[model samples]
Target: MMKAKQRIIILLLAGLLVLTAASCSSQKAADPATETLKLGVLSLEDILPMVVANEKGYFAEEGLTVELIPFQSTVESQSAIQSGDIDGMMNDMVVAALLKESGTDLKVTSVTLEATDERRRFAIVVSPDSDIKTVADLKGRELGISFNSIIEYTTDEMLVAAGVSPEEVNKTAIPKIPVRLEMLINNNIEAANLPDPLITFAEFNGCKTIIDDRGRSIS
Candidate 1:
């Protein structure tokens, strides 16, 4: 059996050990890794939840300091990521797939949105005065489209479904939807392909939707 003083010394040593353990835990809690994390967002609408997360301090509660950077295009946002100017981005799957195919350092960490209707985000149209009433009527008529994306695939599908071969239409490449819209408005092209909200805008300006992929599958 130990003497009473020895017993007290053992108790004190045990207390010291407990205090040391508590100190270590406190240091860990205060470490820089516990600090807020930086993140990037493509646009306000691209991921509204991210905007809400930042505005409502949800990320702050999670120890994150997400910096939302709005870019004109997904390509611009992806470029920012590649250059390390931003940590990550909420962008289109095509951009992500391209990056992965090329073995880019960036990986799509999460998918915020999956495209369902091709026309949910895009639409095919003709001018009100134009005789082109159906997709079949698009033969020899100008059709505008962006290159090498879901747009191309969906447009090709639209053409095929309308009994029009892809070769039948005068395919024009106007990469920007706004430019395509301008062409449509100016009658430079009998038909123009554009994405939303340009689709909505074009329709508002009297462009007719001859074919829509709203309920159609692009996959």
Candidate 2:
């Protein structure tokens, strides 16, 4: 019940974000009366607001029907969007830009999550058995991240802040979040950047966080 309430509050904030972004990008939001929107999303915790809102009839109150579609990976979700299977997506800025670059008509609708001074959504963690103890130790090391995505972007930003040059930053692309988490837990990957719940789960499983998006503007 507490979690549900928390998600409801987040839903309010997300509602504001969507309205503000929609107004900036266009004249106004689509008429909610008798409108239906099919939205695609990965199975990430950030979907809580959407879930809560839908369950609570927030959209219905606005006369909109939102259908949430689940995709296992970002690539799958992007493909679905390209093929017109879904009208919109809950994705990071990096992916939104990628979609625009690939000629898909896209817009920054809203931010599901962002790093704040008190909290961050992403982190770089090392296996319990791995020798990489510090951020500096990650230079030229195998760091798993989804290439050209927000995962890699966050990793790079944090690495450079720790004095690791772009050339020295070695990153391995493991796009699937579950795969990255599994590999890191199994010691198949020395380190990987993961979002909140997964990052906390990995830490519970003995992974050590060396750096995160905390205090940084990037998310």
Q: Number of clashes in every candidate structure? A: 0, 0
CA-only RMSD, every prediction: 16.5, 4.1
lDDT of 2 by residue, 30-147 (tens): 6666556878876677887787788987767667898988775677777777877777777777877777787777666556767789887899999989999888998788888887
State the weakest 10-residue window (summed lDDT) of model 2.
Answer: 15-24
Give per-residue CA lDDT, model 1, range 1-118, as digits (tens).
2354444334323321110111223344543345433354432233555555567665565565656666654456556666656655655556666766776555444443323654
How far is 145's C-alpha from truth in model 2 (Å)? 0.7
State in Å the error of residue 125, model 2: 0.6
- Candidate 2 structure lDDT: 0.78
lDDT of 2 at 85: 74
Tell me each candidate's TM-score.
0.64, 0.82
Model 2 regions lying over 4 Å from their true place: 1-36
